[model samples]
Target: MRTRGTGDACATYNQFSLGADYAVSKRTDFYLVAAYQHASGDQRDTNADGTNGGLGEATASIGSYGNQSNTNSQVIVALGIRHRF
Candidate 1:
């Protein structure tokens, strides 16, 4: 996290994340991840987690899918397959 100004000013707040993964087979897997973030002052017109800073509040973020939460918290899920060639 970074400060909102050049001085020691806290523009961001508390945050947390949780994730889990499971393997259905030797080459198959699934994953689930979720996170939460809070803001107080200003997030440069955005949330601390890449979400829209609606009314300058808290928000959340998704995975690398370029998606984010519409509210202060969000969840992300992924299912994939892997092979050892």
Candidate 2:
């Protein structure tokens, strides 16, 4: 599971995972998996040369759509192996 942004960075919504599979005979098998995730936030930018431009230019002079920030993070990894008859 993973999530981000929502009241004080939503506690960073971190995550981790792991898996494994093994078989040496009758066909052959060896599998492994792993996963990780991270999140962070606190850089809301209304766009003013601060980057993270999702909606900028002074809210388009009035339309209002200038506010985009990003600093969240994420990571994941996995290994695999299979054999079938």
**Which candidate ranks first by TM-score, i.e. highest?**
1
What C-alpha lDDT do the candidate models reach, one value each? 0.52, 0.46
Alpha-carbon runs more than 4 Å astray in model 1: 1-9, 43-85
TM-score of every model versus the real structure: 0.47, 0.32
Candidate topping lDDT:
1
User: Residue 68 lDDT in model 2?
Assistant: 24
In model 2, how large is the Cα lDDT of residue 6?
56
Over 4 Å off, model 2 = 1-13, 26-29, 42-75, 80-85
lDDT of 1 at 11: 48
Candidate 1, position 74, lDDT: 53
